[model samples]
Target: MSAGRHGRHEPVYRALELIANGLVRAQRLDLHVTGLENIPDTGGAVLCVNHTGYVDFLPLALGVQRAGRRTRFLIKSEVMDIGIMRFLVNHTRTVPVDRSRGAEAYRAALGRLREGYIVAVYPEATISRSFELKEFKSGAVRMAAEAGVPIIPAIVWGAHRQWTKGGARNMGRSRLPVHVRYGLPFTPGPDESPERETLRLRETMNSMLLEVQDSYGPHPPGEFWVPSRLGGAAPTPQEAAVIEADEALRKAEARAKRAADRARSRGSRR
Candidate 1:
């Protein structure tokens, strides 16, 4: 069965909460949450989160559940394509974002917000390989502005150790430390530009992340999944920037070489 056309995911969402609760217990994951009361209990709002790892979603969902509200995440369309997972995701009222047609997802999110439901958006758009906060996209702020709802910034630290884009796997760690903190909800300033609003959101998120990291104690030694700032093997933000720049240079060189090779071949043929 699917969620009602009106977008109610209740009973099923409640069930999802139960399952999430069980998963936390079974996995022996340690979750630390703060500022959850900032989530508006009776109105539409946007939860803007940082993208760290694949496993991060569960904790974020649990945080929202604990806040006494049901939330629909803006998930990748590819996840909804999974045959078995599609049914569950659909009934949970998650919004599917086709990268090519991102506007549709924005509209769906706005619609949900208008219906007085909570919507979660990852402003980074994708997981950061460096396990650090990435540049923010304007989507979250745009949605909140257009929907006339407040935006709550949520930062989750430590999930990157479980599974990250860098391919580090530390899921076997018992009682893995994870912290989720929600910042106070704030609405966009009147006539605020998307870039300005996004910048504000990014600052709030990064600050929250740093606070969580500070209180969580030192990270696991020699773990590639840990952020470099915490003494792990993950690259620092500066290192990641250099790596990205080097990659762009390498790709440019390869394209130039290919073009030259093609030119030489055409000349020879002539």
Candidate 2:
């Protein structure tokens, strides 16, 4: 869903307003967005969120839309396959990513930000079984560093509980309280190593997550474990298992996808 796909960008502004208003009405959840002033009234910027629950996406976008800005997400290809979602995202300038192709995703993400659209991507790239931040993928760090835009750290709380541990999927009209918090944008230091960039971003995200969580009284157990600093040790063994599984699944999926693509190409050539 490239920004250029849509002709005449006027509808995008009105449409986002409708979507944001609808999301707030339907969810009936309270939202408190801090540092809203930090977001430049206009221009391209990256909003990095902690991915946990399904509702997190809407909350993340709602914050951007609320601040009177258009948001483009570097999302999964599967999401784009949905008819309504694809239409909405395309009009909004989202870049759908097939993680199997890292280089392609990078190019697409960079392209959107360069085009003066606010972009969002999750550093962890997947939800945590336990509500603790996992070791982040370097994508957010790389994208933010290369794009050279203010990366705003956002945190979402309460969406994780909407999922039942058994299915851990689908919340059909489920009533879940949600909170969104945005942190002041920060510039990654000059000559920063990928490691440093990743860690710095992680720490900012961690703080924002904590602030959002704390705002929702009665902490969701284990939210306290993520330190105020980035690249900190992961949670305990029980929690680490989920993070490990997420990593392994992502790697396996990426490999399988590439293999399939190569096989298809070879067959086509034959």
Candidate 3:
């Protein structure tokens, strides 16, 4: 196990880690991990992972644990509000972020990094409905730069097969394969702008993801969660854009109808 410079060792956190990691192992999911050596044995670093599904975070956490470190994730504030999830995340020392207030989240993450803890951020901000890397926001790069820690790009593919934002009715499959790969950490120059660094980070992550997919061979058929390149039913970015637009239009129409109905009721009363 790689030694962490200042990993958390609270009894409760350790207990939960054991249980959650045990659950992951019990799933008997096929997990292939690479670039384990790229993780520094001891230091505070920003771990930037591409989110694909509900269970994507676990695989990355397991890999980080295997490297002898603990990761505190910048998680959605909604999850922090759930009863059991709140308890678990609090014990895990995770940072909860109101998605709209990114600055607050960055400050919290910066505090963790200054304390020599690894902070994980999903730069894409959400699960990519298209099942491919999307444009990254600048938060991760900014956090790394401000904290003076290197950004470690970790890519996970195949977890979407088990569960994804679109659908997961096929999760009962006997065997699911998940690939997790970490990359060499790099620091942004002090003089470099966060925008440029973000672009570089995105490119690095995309290239690494492509390599992961190619090496994993073809994704099986009838799997809607798999990316299009792997011959699955996942949507492309353009397709996803149209789907989102249509959904938004439907929602707008619903809201307008409700408003009209309320207005008609008021007029009838008068």
What digit string (tens of lDDT, one per residue) describes model 3 on residues 8-84? 55777677678866676677678898998988877689999998888898889878878877888887788876899
Model 2 clashing-pair count:
0
Q: Judged by TM-score relative to the true structure, which candidate is superior, 1 or 3?
A: 3
Better of 1 and 2 by TM-score: 1
| Candidate 2 minimal-lDDT segment of 10 residues | 225-234
Model 3 off-target regions past 4 Å? 1-8, 169-173, 245-270
Candidates' C-alpha lDDT = 0.81, 0.69, 0.83
Give lDDT tens digits, candidate 2, residues 1-270: 233222235586566667666766675655555666766676567788887665577766767756666677787888887899888777666788886687997898888777767788888877664556777888776777787877888887766555523234534455556777778887666598878888988987777776666566653333332322323232554765666688799989998999999999999999
- Report the error of model 1 at residue 213, Å: 0.7
Write model 1 residue lDDT over 216-264, tens digit each, in one string: 8777776786788777887888888777677779979998999999999
**Which is the leading candidate under TM-score?**
3
| Model 1, C-alpha of 234: deviation from truth (Å) | 0.7
Question: lDDT rank, highest first?
Answer: 3, 1, 2
